[model samples]
Target: MARNRILPIFVPHWGCPHQCVFCDQRTISGCHRPVTATDVTRLLTEALPLAGQGAEVAFYGGSFTAIPAEQQQELLDAVGPFLRTKAVGSVRVSTRPDTITPETLERLWRGGVRTVELGCQSMDDAVLKASGRGHGREVVAPAVALLRQYGFSVVLQMMTGLPAQTDESALKTAWALAALQPDGVRLYPTVVVRGTVLAERYADGSYRPQTLEEATALGAEILECFLRRAIPVLRIGLQPSEELAKSVVAGPYHPALGELVKSRVYRNRAQALLETVTPGSDTVLAVAPNRVSLMTGQKRCNINWLRQRYGLHSLRIVQEPMEDWEIRLQSSESLDKINR
Candidate 1:
């Protein structure tokens, strides 16, 4: 199914029973007000026209199914008129993995929810426990199976740098998530927002968040795992907001983190291709117009790295209309192309 522009509705921290160590939903989401059905109606009424008729309204920042039955229906019922008139094509919601049930899926299917996002933070039970995620790793596959059985698109979320998580452990988590065959994946490295339990841990030297460099490096590998499986990675890192910026005390927080991760992935591919090159060879790399920056990297870091690592006498970048992540390497002697 084709994806339209998403119209997001943030209901921060609503009906969340467990306060995960790394979460401060209101601060992270930049939404402080209590949301009602009226708010959902009024906001979408004005935004849907600009978003296009095929847009899906996403309920984010909380467990939509775990809330009281009446409250959940109130929100879904508010979308009734829009669904009828085709102002919105469908509904999507994010919730904790353990909260999903066949009954809940049935209700959502009846209410026009076509997609469900589960916050499956880690696949290691120890990591989950350390981070205060109450559910075990076992719940994830069952939840995914149930969602697919109900004919809903499943999106699995994973995190890195949680307490007791290593780079090896993070990659293991990625591998576990990939085996489930999700419709898409989202990667978020842990962040320490102020006023959360994580903040208190950071103050006393009990926890360490991944550095920007660390997160980017690990993210490149994690992204590769999904890409190899032909799974689309819908997003990487947190969405930036002035409120989120002000609230974060620490962690691998960059506004353009997804770009950094993608760049590293391209750089890795180029590095592998360059390993067979003769020393002092002049070369030119061609990529899609929109991917030039990602291929070149910030401050032309990828270019500089290749020159140093491969002993290239001259390196140049030229843009061309090409497939995404396609990089063609032409040296003075040989024309070598790598495609993915």
Candidate 2:
């Protein structure tokens, strides 16, 4: 398989109509100056030569389509040469759902954008309102439908730990997002960045941030929503950056949060498989070699927990080629079972 890479151009808050309570665009993008079409061209020129053919140019950290049509085209047009030469795949941009329209989609399509990612933070109106997203759930379905109508690949982004967000509301958003059946989703457990309203709320105790444990537990369940529907989740938690680290005031922020959440999912599955095993029995789990660390967890945490939870005399993981979700029991005793 060709290794796919992302050549990102940070537009920052170029076209954002609102200062979302949780975002610090300058800090997150590390772009102190406004991004221009010239900047896009210069950045791409400097970067694309080393990028693989599978490299995808993505506009991150702002509403790309929400920007003026001429400006949006200018950025997209900058990618024209790379597309013509097959240096990279078509571009992808993240935008607010309400910004999506026939006019914008058509312009994007004409400019060679193949994927449209919507920041559909929540599907509940109250949660949306409390989060100050400036748009409601009503626009999401129509936006997704229009994207699909244009034959563009759709990716939706949702967040957890918003103001007034509840477990049920988050899950409902996930389930509702799954119904739209986008090509992929990005699940973010909110982090309170400094200099934002969320930060103020955190300081005042008006908003409580999720501990790493709490966030991971909830993140695992939310991830399962997409897993069950076979909708690919592109990310979990924020990608660690120096700026982000410096900006975080509080909340479930971790560098390897995705791995942590995946490990938690593994724990859940391991527990289920362990349930069928006899108490105090020696057992072995066979997983793909690449997944050893994840299944074993950081510092063998999963192994220790499983041993104690299942009352097993011994438990070990053996290398084997299998699906990521597959774990086969290789026990000398009668605990032979396989988790599908």
Which candidate's TM-score is highest?
1
lDDT agreement with native, every candidate: 0.90, 0.87
Give residue 300's lDDT in candidate 2 (0 to 100): 93
Residue 97 in model 2: shift from native, Å?
Answer: 0.6
The estimated TM-scores of all candidates read 0.96, 0.95
Per-residue lDDT for 256-314 in model 2, tens only?
99999998888888887888999988888878888888889999999999999899998
Candidate 1 lDDT tens digits, 1-340 = 4576888998888978899999988988888976899999999999987888778999999888888878889999999899999989999999998999888898899899999999998999999999898889999999999999999999999999999999999999999999999999999989899999999999999998899999999999999999999888999999999988998999999999999999999999998778888889888888899999999999999999989999999887778789988888776544444431
| lDDT, model 2, position 334 | 40
lDDT of 1 at 339: 31
Q: Residue pairs in steric clash, candidate 2?
A: none
Off by more than 4 A, model 2: 1-3, 333-340
